[model samples]
Target: MDGYRGFLGLLVSALLVGFLSVLFTLIWVLHYREGLGWDGSALEFNWHPVLVVTGLVFIQGIAIIVYRLPWTWKCSKLLMKCIHAGLNAVAAILAVISLVAVFDFHNARSIPNMYSLHSWIGLTVVILYILQLLLGFFAFLVPLAPLSLRAFLMPLHIYSGLLIFGIVIASALTGVTEKLFFALTKPAYSTFPPEGVFTNTLGLLILVFGALIFWIVTRPQWKRPKEPNSVLLQPNGGTPEGVEGSMAINFGKADSESNNEAAARKRNLPLDEAGQRSTL
Candidate 1:
């Protein structure tokens, strides 16, 4: 199971890298066009390509949410299998979107609105992909493991989730801005300017909100008695778990006996029936 989870983590991490790479590339391409003062062609109404891929990415996000639901942890084997299938489907969709976006960017003559769609979809893919990976990794590590291991992975998972959320929110805001202002601005000029200050302000506000949420979620929590043992073992230090305490005690006793025996041997002490040191 650990192996399986590790493999899944690697898979999701790879997909995330691909999605982010393509997304950043698309952003750079847009900036390049803007710098060149290029009025790129309008978005085409080709539903066959964009809608199909977007639909898949959207489904992937929904699948991740279903898979990570708390109730799924205690779900039946059949249900677990279904959830696993959902995760795999997400991974598959992400892979397809990443491939299609790369090809579209490479072959296009000018900047396409589909690039914006790709970026948004890629963000959704990465956010959900990461969440699913962390949940799977934690679910595997938390059982039949020492508290120390759980302590190590728990905060990591939480912080990563918060980051994912921020990314998702940014992607959504960017999508809205690109659609409302970039797509409809020219046609709706009777109501507002093509590049309205309001849209930019909204985008900025979205970024600020995302940043605030990141800060809030990542802030340190005050130490409490009922807090889980893992929380205490954070780098800031709190308290260790009971099982960890027991392991420490047992290890200390073993180390003490070994040191005593070594001291006895150095002093040429008498031997016991088992040919071991009698005393130090």
Candidate 2:
């Protein structure tokens, strides 16, 4: 299980690292295009599609944290069960929202109001998501916490949350800035270029930092003293016995009345009977 989990963690970490790298490269490309004074044709206002997809990603990020919390805290089984149910409920709602966005986008349906709504709501969600992540971290220190919960999910939660934050913040900033620019200047993509480069670079830096943190937290240390083993049974008729006493008691004759009677009968036998008994 540990090996499987380690593989999963490495896979996720690699994917996130790759994603951040791509995002950074794109951001740089966008900035370079803008610096070179290229027309906004290279930049389009099609981020709504990306936003819808990424919003679902954000939801996944939140779900990971929420699902992990109870396990990390070693909460009561009932509480953990309840939390699982609640998280599932929230995930269902988000899933519906994501589906609606997908269909809406496909049908060429534009909700100008929804654009603002999704933006603000997403920003709020990201903030809470970050807070939940912070709390999820505390779960690691508690030994009673489930290993799968911490070892497998925690790093993903951290990395995913950071990535989501970067993406959402960039999306929000670019969105608001573009809107303002359009309101003031004009509806030309030339006025403001996509800031993907800066956002991506920021995300990469965050991923690196997160990796460093994970290493620091999970590094091995000297072993702790084990609990003293409890004595489950005793020798010498239930009395406490040290090692030597326990050995002696096992090797000695029975201390019961039956053994004493048998000894007395042997001693009382006549010499001839004793000799015959001994020969027998």
Error of 2 at 120 (Å): 28
Q: Score residue 135 of candidate 2 by CA lDDT.
A: 48
Candidate with top lDDT is 1
Tens-digit lDDT track for model 1 on 1-280? 2244543453454345334433433343343223212122222212212322233333333343343333344455346646655554555565555445544543564454435664666446565755556565445433444456666676765555555545555564555455455445445624665344444444454444444333332333311113122223342333355446456557779999999999988776444533663443
Best by TM-score: 1
Per-residue lDDT of model 2, residues 131-167, tens digit only: 5434453554332444444556657755755565455
lDDT of each: 0.45, 0.43
Give one clash count per candidate, in the order shown.
Answer: 0, 3
Assess candidate 1 and give its TM-score to the true structure.
0.36
Worst 10 residues of 1 by lDDT: 222-231
